[model samples]
Target: MNYTLNQLRIFLKVVQNQSVTKASEELHLTQPAVSIQLKNFQDQFEIPLTEVVGRKIYVTDFGKEIAEAAEQILQQVSTIDYKTLAYKGQLFGKIKISVVSTGKYVMPYFLADFLKMHPGVELEMDVTNKNKVVKSLQNNEVDFALVSILPEKMKVEKIDLMQNKLFLVGNMEEDFTKKKKIEAILENRPLLFRESGSGTRQTMERFIVQQDLKINKRMELTSNEAVKQAILAGLGYSIMPLIGIRREIQNKDLQIIPLKGLPIKTNWSLIWVKGKNHNPAALAYLDYLKKEKEAIIHSKFSWYEMM
Candidate 1:
């Protein structure tokens, strides 16, 4: 019914080391003190946590669950400390950023550059799928998200970083330009698709529907890298941002088919929960992105034709 923070800390240490004696060593407490804390923790709860299996102490399933929660609880306490320090003009705290997987290609380079410019700032980057990134942003687990898509009707501020031309891609071995129209190449060939919830997928889907094309029949892969590999393997063609496939196109490994009115151009945005207190570092990053968007894109894929 009652628990102490020391008990929680000791329980976490035991879980971390998976040995009471090792936990005692780590906590600078005696083995008996560590055992007592574990016992007290179990007594406060309805279930027992530690059991001796042969020569080692192990946790039950219930204990494992509690240990997991304890980790989060301790993490929150650390966050509070960081927040207090930040509030007191300590501009050297960590900022967690969750970005869509595709953004990994560009976001990390930019972040590294930023950190070099401001060595006092710490960054924690989580590259994830679109849905998970969105969920993390919504939960405030991340300071900001560098994403390609914004949910409709969400209270988020989007900064239009840049507009990119989505291209129809085929292998360089194929004469894509020979085809007068994009529809001519669309018949029976397998069309590669990005995983669901991808902004690129949504853009492609909307373009398909607008053109009255059928959505059935295709392979859906998770990452842009996978899609690129599929395309390189001649699995099928996909509509992808030019930034993603510039090297392949230049190396003469891939060819572009120009559709008179195909590949609906879209913008990438930097987003955060609106009306929430954002870290000053986050705001500074946003401004940096806006001010240097064109330069960044140009430097990365200098040869790619932009629309």
Candidate 2:
């Protein structure tokens, strides 16, 4: 069967999503445009690539096999294109990363200077919980991942970009600056928690166990933003990454509570699977980080160091 690269891409996306509408949304193509390409690609193959029943699309077994082949072919083509750019002495290609939600605040600052330097390079970043971030790395779906807490099971290499500090935070109505016993501070203040599978939640769990503290669990939230809003509403207190709450602290909307062992420390690390062969753009970005990360942290995140 003869088919173009674009057709292969569209067909692969369709097969992956099992819906033309979802594929079009992800690819930034109109539904009709994706449908046209999918139909054209299907016409090239003698075997039926898809079957639709009751307005739902399903890829045939043969289509599943074809989609795997298409993925490999696309990867090869992308490598060749990237190598061509390198041969022309231009740093050009895509770098995809998956980051934990709280890491979003830090990841972009580290990327800005590098991206500015390599204008031809493109970036794709997905921010989600720690579970999804690690899953992306395990599946080889991204070049790297950013997390404050490393996965225990994955054999990976990492560059420690900067320190991540977690502190007890709440609305400024209470005098949280005075040093107080952990239990006293926690009394009557319900603990707002991130949903399970979050790196921040895992850290809080570890701290709770270490301190042998009992928490009045009030709400389980999915995102940092949700937890922040809950705290600002005076619904509860939460342990949050200082990086994500810098603006709130600066604006005096929130304050850090003083307690023994209050700020839990971890490094924000850029990690990748141990033996995966990264493409040129990814390798260049890694090298850039190794050389410039410390300088960037010194200039940008010096406030965390002072705390």
Candidate 3:
């Protein structure tokens, strides 16, 4: 079977957009051309590549897997293209990155520094939750993902960058310092919990279950901001990353209570799909991150005590 790089690119684009029309617009190709290319790609395979549901197109599970392979292939081709251009002593391209929501807080600053180092390179970022981060990596939607929890079976490389400590926060009026474990303080208080699939929430739940404590999950929030607001309003207590609530903790609007017998630490990692190709921009960005990882970690943690 024979396939062109352009056809693989069109297939990947359609899967990413979930719409042939959108892929056409992005690729500046006619809708008919997009459809034809997709058809050609499907014909090459033993099975259909996509199925239409109403007006929208959905790539089959197997098709999605093939698209991932195509993405890696395209990435390798792009790497070669970049190297050809690099022979002239110039680097210019885009490096796409995705990060879990919590990572957004610090990733931008590091990215800014990376930009300063390589002015010709452009950076694109997508912020979402842990599950989405993993999905994005698997789909090759982004070159790298910064996240706290690494999934179990993915063929990816993870570099442990920093440790984010989980803290229990309550209204300033409540003093849980006398209480050792989170179970004790939460006995009579309402607990605000982040939604499922959240790294912070997962960490908190694992801690609670490991301690054999019964937690009353009175409320659920989708974001750290909402949880902070709920806790500050005295509606409930919450467990969050210390960095996430640094300001409130320092302003005396919220109090951080230590937990005993609780594993309240999470390791943040910079991850990329294993064996996938990397362009100059991607490599440069990764190098910049590794070089500044220590300084970045130091600066972020230094302010935790103040807050």
Candidate 4:
């Protein structure tokens, strides 16, 4: 009945990880400290929050529900803290965005200037796969989502940022110039794929379907960086975002093989729930993007088209 917010945080981390060691590591505390706090928290409730079996920890059903509630509680408390601090700065609080993995390369450049201008503003950007990005947006866990492919059922307002182009990318070892045929390039070389729900993978699938081609998915990676590494090692070719691989192309480590009906293009967009009320920082961020997007693109991303 007298558990502190710190206890709640410890308990939540323990439940999320189902491992006291991992929770301790993430909390930057010792295992004994995490265990002590978790035990203190659990003592306040009648039912068991977690159980240890065969030296492994497992969160009980009640623990899962309580963890969810704790997350909401912590989120609200954070909002309150930020709100209290807002009076100190011109435009203060947090700007939270969940972005598709490739978006990591793009979003930060746009945000750097804005953050510098508003010294008190804080940025929380989550770089994840498309599925997690969409889920976070749908759950209202983030103020905005940066994506190329919009979610199907969400009534979201989108601010188009710029073009996102996907090209068949390979290590320099591949002889792309000699064989431009879709079938020839796709033939012997296995295709490295991003896991399902990646925007690039979806785009690649659509391209395959449209061309009536089949790819041998010999290697699959969950992140753009990992895919790039696999390609650099000559594992296989992959359809990759030009933004994520521009440096590699420039360095001649990777080559973009232009093919007929290639370069699946889409617009990177900042999207949010159509009617959701945005906080002051979020609103200011949207306005900044609206006003400075063109200049930012010209100055920061002019090479996108050239690459």
lDDT of each: 0.78, 0.91, 0.81, 0.87
Per-residue CA lDDT of model 2 for 119-187, tens digit only, reads: 768899999999999999999999999999999988999999988999999898888556887677767
Using lDDT as the yardstick, the better of models 2 and 3 is 2
Q: Per-residue error at 129 for model 2, in Å?
A: 0.5
TM-score of 2: 0.76
lDDT of 1 by residue, 1-307 (tens): 6887788899999988999999998789999999887887898877778788899988889889999999899888777877776777665556788888777765775566667766557788888888888899888898888887687667998777655568788886567545565556766567788888887788788888777776455889999999999888878888888777767877988877777666566666778889868777777777777787677767764565344
Off by over 4 Å in 4: 1-85, 216-218
TM-score, cand. 3: 0.69
Top-lDDT structure, candidate number: 2
Give candidates' CA RMSD values in order. Answer: 8.1, 4.3, 8.2, 4.5
TM values, all candidates: 0.69, 0.76, 0.69, 0.75
- Residue range with the least summed lDDT across 10 consecutive positions in model 2: 176-185
Clashing pairs in 4: none
Q: Give the per-residue Cα lDDT of candidate 2 at 298.
A: 91
Angstrom error of the Cα, residue 59, model 3: value is: 24
lDDT of 1: 0.78
Model 2 regions more than 4 Å off: 1-84
Cα-based lDDT at residue 156, candidate 1: 93
- Residue-wise lDDT of candidate 3 within 1-307, one digit each (tens)? 8899999999999999999999999889999999998898899988888899898788898998999999999989877876776776777799888888888776776777778766667677888888888898999888889888888798888677777777777888765657666666767777888888988888888877877878764788998889988888888887788767767767888887766653377777889999989987898778877788889767756775343
Positional deviation of residue 294's Cα in model 4 after best superposition, in angstroms: 1.3
Error of 2 at 151 (Å): 0.7
* Runs in model 1 lying further than 4 Å from the true structure: 1-90, 305-307
Ranking by lDDT: 2, 4, 3, 1
